[model samples]
Target: MTKKSETGSTKSETKSKSEIRNWAPINEIANDVRAGKITALSNVEKSIGLIEKHSEFDAIISVLDEPAKKRAKQIDARVNNGEKAGRLAGVPFIAKDNFLVFGGETTAASNILKGFEAPYQATVINKLEAEGAICIAKANLDAFAHGSSTENSDFFVTKNPIDKTRVPGGSSGGSAAATALSLAPFSLGTDTGGSIRQPASFCNVVGFKPTYGLVSRSGVVAMASSLDVIGPITKSTEDAALIMDVIAGKDKLDMTMIDRDILAYTKFNNNLTGVKIGVEKEYMDEKVDKEVKQIISVAIEKLKNAGALVAEVSLPSSKLGLPAYYIISLAELSSNLSRYDGQRFGYSYPDAKNLDESYMLSRDIGFGDEAKRRIMIGTYVLSSGYYDAYYKKAQIVRTKIINESREAFSKFDFLIGPTTPTAAFKIGEKSQDPLQMYLSDLLTVSANLDGGPAISIPAGFAGSLPVGLHIMAPQGEDRKLLGIANGFEELSK
Candidate 1:
């Protein structure tokens, strides 16, 4: 059994442990808190200690020290009063900096928005708080969610927790690293184009990107309006499902949100007797790492052994998904990022001659190189002469990808592949070459392009580095996707 110190004081007062390997799951922590085996304050202190010890990863951009402690005390009081706490009560979790939480700045890991405090809580934050989950800190990400790697973050690049020299994928890099290192039980991350799933794959954790419009994006910093979805990265699929239950619902604030019956995603814990799993031949080709492909092959065999029919399915349009996604995402980003023009909020450059100069100087200094590249690409694509050739053509291609995915799903319940072409690469491995970095997301971007639900679960390791099995289902099939992942998790275990 896991043990805790008895002194019941701040993290500074406790004796430190060196292993850095002992930590309990969220459900186990909650059970201990409720049964008085440990106090919530002690748990929060330990989490704070872990964060401080692993500061090199730069996973936490800001820690809500006082507010988190106060919230933990309130939860303990409620338990003492004999009140029923919600499912995730007294659990500690982190929210990516893109989320607007009350106690800390939602910088989105950009200098342009540094120290900008939110007046209102994000809907997902509010929902988790209602369930007694404490928002301990804000995790780092690619600034404005613009890049495939967290190197685009203005503050710092998040290192992969498994191997300190490698990167944890992004824009959800910090969230995945935090959970991987057990800094928090789970963390909320936003996925636009393979952000959540890819990072989770690198960190060997469970990352769930729900169906588009299933989770409210009311207060999330918008990257690509059509592709952004808030999801959870956790140690286990069941925990991911638990976090989803709290945050999934219709919100009047986000008009794109739909009112659908939210099912208990945990109920997906069953054998995969009748499930049909499809392996995309395009994703299994020679372009992917041999070991990563082997891991996925093993997962497919496990599913087949569990009585699920497995077959290779063709998604010819998937090859065009990355280019199409970049075009669409940049077009949307170009428009969304226009709001940061020094007037209303965010940072403004000094010594500007006029409005135009201020806008130009501020943005030039504020955005990183990769961000500027995308902005320029977006401007060029949306420009009058090239609009039809680039932007419009990408949209037409996107439509084709979506239609092809729908058709494939009509025959197979879920599509499976390697979540990423390889495991976590070195931190500076592909930073200088933007196109090489973009190709890192080749296998994971199709689901985002099609606006479907997808997940990445740890399948096995390629040597010491972990690989993830990618599973995707049609839009509005969040429950089914989780169920299928749960089935795979059980079989793999």
Candidate 2:
């Protein structure tokens, strides 16, 4: 059934499953592309082919076919001409739909923003493309990155690659699922309250959330501005580290942007000897599933055996993480979502009697339930009457959580815990109960609340489901955190 081409190579030979899978790491692929061993066009096609093959997973929102192919050809030309190819030459990756990307409508999985095109690419996308990484598609996410499950998306819910019947953790579920399925070697996701790490945990990949402002958030869709931090979901810590090296830096566009570490992120020190790690009591509470607790405990024991100094640590304010995060996030979200008021870009009311009616109807019809709920709660908290009692108090609690985390770091190098209370839950399991849905972030929100770096890595499994070992370090210690996670990844093996 195979036909030989003019070059005497069968068409199928060019489409080998391994080539389509892109199993090589970033460095290997980049080196090969630069050396002309593999054409950039072929790399792009491989990623696109794999994405099409796994279309049923609902992981992608839109594919940048023409753009990606065009970029690939340009990169191929550069390498063919003996030019200096960038570090990520010919690598194809995915970005969460929430990100503002060129060549596709950055819907953010919400009807309000449906069909809206980005005026320009996100800073992260710009940086990646500068190094020859092509974003082949925009992955799905919860509507406006609002929910714990992709079930809240205005589009179809993204299926968990491991268990289609189950939910992929959200609002970065699509990115995680895509990364898990190898639709791309890696993908980008924004974490405001475990959006990145939770899904990464569920899908059994490495998800890293850098310290706040470490990566420029310019051009990304606004979520809770204070809490939002974008990171990667990839197969290994090394890949994430290599990516961090490229994307981690200050940008004039984002006022909050900070300078990156002087040391290259790719230089990971795997030695855990004498490293002090604290096991948070609250994160490993009795409420955590027995299987998950055991798996996490075993992972911790691996660290101890590898010469890490392990000890019990408590942060009572950790209990306030969830509540504080929700309040501040919602308040910020309310202010951010206010931009979609029918007049600007995105969906506007087609039938409206007047401006006021247009504003009301557009938002009412455009936003999903979860988005509306957050907007309402945020508005309520920021309202004059409740601002002092709710928003102000929440900010105070946030400071306390940050202080407690800093205090812990003063004594310990990193704090560890289970990324979630349980593994991937069945779709619609907790969607009906907001409280239960919120509980899913119980263990992962403090890092965001305090602007500390955090990462989730695979820790064996709880039954058949993957459990993530959540790791946290003090603010601005993202490089060290990546090093620690990489060490654990090696130690666990």
Q: Which runs in model 1 stand beyond 4 Å of their true positions?
A: 1-23
Number of clashing residue pairs in every model? 0, 0
lDDT of 1 by residue, 284-399 (tens): 99889998898888888889989999999999989999999899889888888888887778888989999999999998887778778888888889999999999999999999
lDDT of candidate 1 at residue 470, scale 0 to 100: 95
Query: Model 2 Cα displacement at 92 (Å)?
Result: 0.1
- Which pairs clash inside model 2? none
List the candidates' TM-scores in order: 0.94, 0.95
* Superposition error at 396 for model 1 (Å): 1.1
Per-residue CA lDDT of candidate 2, range 97-188, in tens? 98888898999999998999999889999999999999999999999899888999999999887677789899899999888888877899
